[model samples]
Target: MGSLRTCSRSACERAAVATLTFVYSDSTAVLGPLATYAEPHCYDLCTSHAERLTVPRGWEVVRLALPTTPQEPHPDDLVALVNAVREAATDRNQDTGPGVRGSKGTLEPPAGAGAGGARRGHLRILREQ
Candidate 1:
């Protein structure tokens, strides 16, 4: 949601249309569509630079084509978001009491939920690659 970044080329002020990344160890140059977030070591390139990009002596240039249809929020997404907000604003917010997270990331079932009937309470965090 921050401001859009422009090309890194000197004296050429244009909205960055692609991202340029170089892998020094692999001798590869990846020039693709702009990333969701700006990276510190990556270079932002405009359309001209993206099309006329070049690689180093033995480096391979991998150009990625951007998707044609932008994935903006559709009507269904808006309706779902609105419904979620309305649900959170209603009485459902009072069900979640404090001490939801146990001593060390343990799943302590909510009040008045049997051992194994159904998952009445929700929200579990799992770390997987």
Candidate 2:
């Protein structure tokens, strides 16, 4: 059996055997092995960093599972399905209007537009004379 491995995050020094691996643009790290282990969904977490975890932005801890018999969609089939979905989404987002100019247009208003042409309230509101 493989020995427990420590978290790769510089701030953390926790031991983990089956860890939910996080693969970012530049680095890969583990979350935890957990006390009560399970296949694919161990709920163990690092108490120290629990409060700091912000979903979608900060560290995303996942449960590690043991290798099991492969089931469901085949690899090639899954790849094809993903490609199809991506292509569909891209097509939906593409500009069907005039030309390249329409392609540059955004779905929402530009940054500075305010509600009812009112100045942004967050900025300092000068009292009218």
Cα RMSDs of all predictions?
12.5, 18.6
Model 2 lDDT-worst window of ten: 120-129
Per-model TM-score versus the true fold: 0.52, 0.21
TM-score of 1: 0.52
Candidate No. with top lDDT: 1
Q: What lDDT does candidate 2 reach at residue 89?
A: 45
lDDT digits (tens) for residues 22-80 of candidate 1: 98999999988788789999998887888888886888988889544333436897789
lDDT agreement of model 2 with the native = 0.44
lDDT by candidate, in order shown: 0.69, 0.44
| lDDT of prediction 1 | 0.69
Candidate 1 differs from the real structure by a C-alpha RMSD in angstroms, to one decimal, of: 12.5
Q: How well is each residue in 20-126 modelled by candidate 2, as lDDT tens digits? A: 44467535345543444344442233444432444464545453453332223358986897679657646755746435543533233345655443343353322
Displacement of residue 50 (Cα, Å) in model 1 is: 0.7
lDDT of 1 at 67: 44
